[model samples]
Target: MQQKGGAAPSLFRNGFLQTILLSNVLLQIGIWVRNFAILLYVSETTAKDPYAISLISVAEFAPIFVFSFIGGTFADRWRPKRTMVWCDLLSAVSVFAVLLTIHFGSWHFVYLVTFISAILSQFSQPSGMRLFKRHVPEEQLQQGMALFQSMMAIFMVLGPMLGTFVYSTFGLETSIAVMGVVFLLSALVLVRLPKDEQEPRTEEGKGQFRREFVEGFRYVWHSPVLRMLGAAFILAGLAVGVAQALGLFVVTERLGKTEEFLQYMLMVNGAAMLIGGGIVAVFAKRVAPQILLAIGMVVGAVCTILVGYSTSVPVTLVVQFVNGLVFPCIHIGISTMILQWSHASIVGRVNGVLNPMFVGMMVVSMSLAGPLKDAFSLVSIYVGSGLLFLFGALMMIPIMGHKAPEKAQAAAPAPAAVRTEP
Candidate 1:
């Protein structure tokens, strides 16, 4: 593991990093605006029906389950710059199509737009990961991941607020147009990325999508660290999924709070994540990633349990904040581990395989959360989830005792391999 001094490291010295961050910030803003606008549009247009609102979530998430692995496969083969740019361009076009559909007097196209954007995002995300792996130095990978996540944390807090403001003040059409324009701008900015420096593909690599896809799975299965990581993520997802599924009920029925209070709690958590991401970015290199991850999981598990048992609103909010703060530790640890352990050749596919384990499991856990709450109680669900988190934390202990696999060490590229043009 690489350690830096206490002062903040200068990751921004690289022009490529600056360009990607600027474009990503703009793209995130547009996405958040579009997301909130569509959400509000669905709520208002459907008379606040729960089913209609749920459809938006389904539309947004289903593609991840269906296409993430495929996206990862293609991400490995394709130039990251071109793939990301085209995905953003296509997303912009999709948003414009949604605008056109609305103008033609049909509201149903909103879900289609959401679904299409999500599908494009599946492609863009893996390619972005590949780019990050290629450009960031090994020593600063954790910090890079933390900084990226911090950006996401900032957006999570502000995006919805901005989206709501834009929708309410300017109206849906204008909001959608703004979203399209931002995406287009993001694409244009991406054109500034230095050309990809990937190894040339062999003739055998030209047309073997199925074989390549299967190989990704095989690689993950062969890697002990990745195998365990997948398992941990699945359990973490279950824990989180149950909490999310029942959070509103816990607020209303248990804490005697309104929806507004729930919103505040979420906002507070988002703000905490922003703080936590900065902390990790500065200090992550000092600690072993596995140890940090274990600590994060254990703390997060305890917080989850406390949130279940705590009756006071203030107490729960504090717990939620702590939860937010610690959760990023696990995320940063895992992301850095991926960068460290996996060869660049397969990192995209590794991400593709690993992402679904967490997301798909979350979906499954969510499906079970309702019935579990109805049959048992909300507290019971929380306890179960906390226990699941504990299990994941415990699983990390064995890995903590060992050094990274020899193959992993051997596979790591030199810093120059990832350094980009000034």
Candidate 2:
């Protein structure tokens, strides 16, 4: 139900909210253990061969670009609660399959664990979003998103440590076993979510993948908000890719510090993200999403330039900290905007369409960052990324002050519905 300038509902009181949050915690534990254990194992086996290590990343991320839309399409067709549960169960099964493969001495097949789990997540994550739409009250959506992102930020701080400790203390076999167990536990937790509403099956729904896929694109294209969001996603993706690719250089060249200092920077950022999520939650109702997103992008742009230009370690760290503080604004704003703008039936497809645009650009920019670095100064590249962020913020201006449509308006025909203003 929509709130009209009243207090929001108690988010924790919702059964779906409680269940999904618990499920996410378990998923994070599994994911981190999987990430670091596989990394350490690959490092040891390949004798730290950079190419071999890079393949792990390829296995993990390649599916998001290749299978995100496909997974999303299926997510729309399937029951969300069942889809999430099955994804986790299948992930657990895949992890154990890889564990057996490892035991049999075909250790290289370990990459299969990461690839399969990653692909399943493409399906699972969108379903989670669908569930969010189903269960979360409109009034509490931002706060709910904040709580969700804060949980992730906590993992950002602790996940690496937990993963490394599990791998180091228990060894590869136990680590993989732990990953399987946590995934199973996550699946169990998701069973507590509200049952999916049953929709009547129609013959028309059976063989319309190609048409539905096209409709997703047309849906986004017809919406002014989504079109601008897609543009912003492209810019943010490029900016983030540049930062991810050259972040080590900020420690090494800009601050003249060793690579170990990078960890401290990450910790600082993660901690700030936790606090930022809280603050955004408190103020979520007071500010519009477009404004929140624009504010974050503007801060991000400034911090990127500052971090790039700062020679002092303290200056760089402060910039990172501040950048982290506003990062959730970007995420929460984007997510809430999508939920508010899109209808429930097409939420998965919308996510699938938008996700690839971001991931695809990030991959492209990461690939380009190397050549760009060779051609230009690091500071200049950073400034260019900062400009990209600014452009992303600019894309939000037209949609500023926009609010979600009423339920009646939302239920109207797609073209007429999306084009309606608050």
Candidate 3:
């Protein structure tokens, strides 16, 4: 399926691509439902303390911060499908365990379950990325990635509403148990994929798993493109994280909100993401890779700033629409470029390295936003987030000089001294 001369694969024939798109839809749907409800569950079940609620969010991501780099490296080393299946199975098991613990135990057990789920899920990202490249032709990467992201957006738009309904009627334990089943469903679909779709990378160590895992970190650190992207990932994530954390407060306080109207705005933003993703899938192949990276960051950053600048909810909604529009391009484009840029062996390590960069940004923003909201205006937080986006744009500069592997080799100049004079 690999295309020469930098051509990407056409999307129609990629079975793995189709399988992932379908599986991710279900996986994300379950995730969206769980994500929205988990915090509320933590607060209600755990005596309603705000700090404990904060921990709910932090606990889910805390392990990702610690394990992401290793996850990425391991992703490269292992068969993506195998790794992915195991992750999903473990996630399902963890959730089921929580249900059992909750039957016998305290509400705090729910929080612990959420944390374990987060750790299991981190491995799936790198695994999926590696798997995609195997069955996908290089030319269709943009469309393929777009299709993947669009599914997540589709689920996000619906997941919260569904979660609310399910939780209200079914109660928390039943809803969570269902979410656990969703992971098993994903695992079932994943099992259908070919085992060999995992791209082979040079294994660094002949000895123990720990040593091999550590080598994954070293491999990623050595690659300049990955190193730079790691930094950019952190910065871009911070801006987005701040905006996400402050969303409800900003909507209710500064801009008066009708509940129905807020829902409409969310719909608009989610639709924009789907639309943007589709557009990127079709048109991105013709664009320069570097330009795609820069444009996505620049537009995403600008939309963020505008979302805060105006007081009108409608205007803010428009900005969010624009933000959604710009976001997929950045996500899909950067992902496409980064995956293309790295070699197979180190894919896991590269992703693992990326873990800290993004997790650091998000952890800082979510933890600090509440205190900062107390100290400074939410508008200032928004504005500060915008400035962070500008920093993300600056990070895109290093994306410019990347040449395809063959092209780089082809472009190397022959020595003049080696040729005899005529």
Best by TM-score: 2
Model 3: per-residue lDDT, tens digit, 161-236?
8887877787778878887999999889887787664222233343245765666555456656556667677887
Model 1 TM-score (2 dp)? 0.93
Model 2 steric clash total = 0
lDDT of each: 0.83, 0.87, 0.71
Per-residue lDDT of model 1, residues 227-280, tens digit only: 888889899989888889888887898899887688888898999999999999
Q: Candidate 2, residues 344-417: lDDT per residue as tens digits?
A: 76778789999888888888898899899999999999999999999999999998856677542363244322
TM-scores, in order shown?
0.93, 0.95, 0.87
Looking at model 1, the pairs that clash are none
Model 3 CA lDDT for position 264: 74
- Specify the poorest-scoring 10-residue window by lDDT in model 3: 413-422
The most accurate candidate by lDDT is 2
- As for TM-score, the candidate ahead, 1 or 3, is 1
lDDT of 3: 0.71
The 10 consecutive residues of candidate 1 with the worst lDDT sum are: 413-422
Error of 2 at 235 (Å): 0.4
